[model samples]
Target chain A: MATELPSNIKSSDVLTDQTSSKWLPPGLALQKVDERIMTLNVGPQHPGSGHMRLIVQIDGDYIVACDPDPGYVHRGEEKMAEYRNYITNIPHLERPVIHDSCNVLYPYVLGVEELLGIEVPERAKYVRVIASELNRCIYIMYWLAIYGIFLGHSTMFMWPAGDRELLIDLMEKMTGARVTHAHFVPGGVRNDLPPNFEEVCLRQVAYFEKRIKEYAAVFYDNPILIARTQDTGVLSRQDAIRLGTTGSVLRASGVDYDLRQKEPYDVYEELDIHSNVMKEGDSYARSKIPWLDMMESCNIIRQALQKMPKSGSVRVKLKPNPKGKGLNTVYKRVESGRGSLGCYIVSDGKPEPYRVKLSVPSFRNLIALPYLLKGEKLGNMPSVYWSLNYWPVEADR
Target chain B: MIGTATGIIRALNSGIKHLAIKRFTLRYPEEKLKFVGDGYQFDPSTGVGIAGLKGRHLLFHDHCTGCQLCSIACEGVAEAIAMVKVPEEHKQNKKAIMPQIDYGKCVFCGLCVDACPFYALYMTNDYELSSFSKEGLIYTPAQLQVKPYVAQDSEIIITSRGATHG
Candidate 1:
């Protein structure tokens, strides 16, 4: 992902030859000697764009290029790791995608295990897969709920969130924390699923299936959406790979590259990963990608549950020492809701990691905006952006 | 060509049916929407009425710690929250405290309610709170404490604020 340029690039570099020099202008004409059109700064605080800011270069009504303004939501996560203990970093990493905390941080914990050469028990791996996939569902549902808000579809926002309450309740019972599940330490998960976990999960799955169909009936097959999204913001296969994209964004462009299926992490190798690929590469494809992935996530959780392995310990139960674990660094990438959520830890083999960098999918998908927006109309910009499912907290981190 | 015609005709039929389904919009004020049981639970604390329901400032002044954390969480352009200290010598263990909310400045993001640690706030469903004076708008801790006698949120006290949340 790091091809060129420094680790730190100044904000002044975001401005291009196309900043309008005016806020209200609609279009710009091009000529050999013409000045670049004006650029608009939309949020660290603005509607449509959530949490982080966007630096958009507009040539008249169309966007010439759009660059993400990261750091408002940075939270100094990498910097914070320098001082915090390994256990302490769990809380901080959880904050990045709090809803998918287990998925984002579980791999980091597993990496620490790899360095220490500690084997996570069988029962714990089964439970971790369930929790992580369920976390993916939680985040994808949240994206759908919020995307409905972006599309001005109020009922869509309310329906998914209301049903999501059941899943949240189930997760809350197991982990204690409603949103942040700081379970899954170096050796294993916090504990086994409580009684009636299977029954409740089955019910939620059934409820989700019905809701998924409803979501499809409302948006998937909706006429107004077809006109707005079909063939809009199309990206070819080559550009997608060259740009370092993954998950649904990569799969939507016919890459067939899923870490769960290809890399075979966890129980995913034993189970068949069902993926629905589309080569259209349009905004509609991007919008529909989450729906496909959500169902796939459900399938993964179901398999992880069915093939429950016999167990040992949940945690490796390390002896505490002020001296720490010592220096060892490991980088682990896991498929998460937004994209490839990679966690890199440089441990001094101490109690705390020397440095931690989270490579979130939102951060990469965010850069894909300018390429998509170049020739699209201003009125259609919101629709294109919503289709991208950009979350500020994940991107900024 | 024949298949495309059937698809268009079916599309038109569904479109008309959808419009008919949505045409049954309730007048809302005259005939309200209903919520099922446990009915509603109105703690003397949390003044927040239900999302679309009607009720005015339900507050808990006795338990308030006056941390001003609510002001920090309010997502708005204005700083509706202000703090004034009672001073050290004035008394109960010489403590210093201040948490004053200016409604004129309050955008009502309910962050204060969430931030209060002690759940001392709520945005009751009272939608009819139109103020003629700027003074009427700035509700102090005292004014925000009690609910109206008539409940002021619904018709005939049949579906009063307390009944829904009780």
Candidate 2:
């Protein structure tokens, strides 16, 4: 049986009532609340929210509250890592952020090397830095493409996507695959750079930098984009720090902390690393920081290529079925594309790790979503939500 | 007002400038992209790998000793490699067993190649492995031994205007 709408209830009111007896079976109805307040599910399937749901409660045009529901794309990556040995875990561990696979694996590799007591070669260190920087650009470009599409800018999407291929091509030459580059192993990289790789890398990186610079004219400088995102969903510095936001979210909030600069893992200490910090904690600044970081990545790749040893072994060969020491634990963190990605490993003299935990930036940055989207307009949802640089798979993993 | 107008104009100008640049895509069926080398190969002595595309795998019948290292390596990751009995007789491979890779499940991680100490298994640039049936996806020892033909000839060429596959 169907029920007619009451005289007082508007057409939009039908959607707001989740416990209406009209749709549900009899006796399933719950108590009703204020009529003006509406609940919006911004997708486990919506274009704006990719593979995650945002339970948004709105009053008129303003958002009263927004709850980010991650784990729709969760694959139990941490549990899977415990079953497999260290070497076998490489393929699946990088699955969370495959576009930036090198950085995602960086922390895990460092932690494993610590447990195994293997000293990485100097050439390998430089090579790892270069790969990490290249992967960072690849990831930022992919993120920028999605961010552009979220803000209804198709041209912004196309330019970053097409320009991204330049780095992807270089990556395909370095590592076999374009995206899921299981290139980083425990000791060092799986393979050394191909012959003539330096010249090709230098040429492509120069062009890629030039290409990304042009994005400012189209995306960041566009009047429409500036107006839509400039002051909306501002995360204050104090709130950001208190909430413990990482990566670009923290950097955009005027907290000048970069793991590569502060911690200096691998060869970051030797290189001139410049952290991009912005005073404006709005969506615009949060989105622009990654772009600036990409420019910095280009410089890093050039420097690493120059300083890399002329000829040496990239990987320290280990015995088959390598096992970590008994009663050992190591924690390692690196600056991934999204933010500071940390890996915690516990070994008990077994081929398989006793415990593996990945503290991903996407999940850490997600804590700021409800805080940022609290009083933002419904129209500003996409820009504000995406500018936090939250990747759903990484967050859920 | 002037700043807004100028910003709009600059965005428009940049978009228009890209119109003159060449399209950055390959006509896939007619033109295939070229690869750097024969395939991804590892030297057990050097303990380092050579860079190449990780497509379908190539198994050397003469080199493989039925050690089952590739199968063991792939068990945790994809379970794509399975040891199968071979009819062909070889002096090195006394057990007459070799790896049969199911392409449908293979993640192309190249761990199997790295695991093979005898230089028996290596990945080739032949990535195109589509078939009508799932059964056709699994390549047997005999099938893996044969080198598939690849027609790839295109590579990315950067110019003053832009980069394009040429």
Backbone clash numbers for all candidates listed: 30, 0
- What would the per-residue lDDT of candidate 2 be over residues A167-206, giving only the tens digit for each residue? 9999999998989999999888999999999999999999
- CA shift of A212, model 2, Å: 0.7
- Highest DockQ model number: 2
Work out the TM-score per prediction.
0.66, 0.94
Compute DockQ for each candidate against the true complex: 0.03, 0.84
CAPRI-wise, candidate 1 is: incorrect
Give the root-mean-square deviation of each candidate in angstroms: 11.5, 4.9
Runs in model 2 deviating more than 4 A are A1-32, A46-50
lDDT of 1 by residue, B11-88 (tens): 456445444231222355565433211111122232211222212445565555666665554422246666555443
What is the Cα-based lDDT of residue A207 in candidate 2?
Answer: 88
| lDDT, candidates in the order shown | 0.62, 0.91
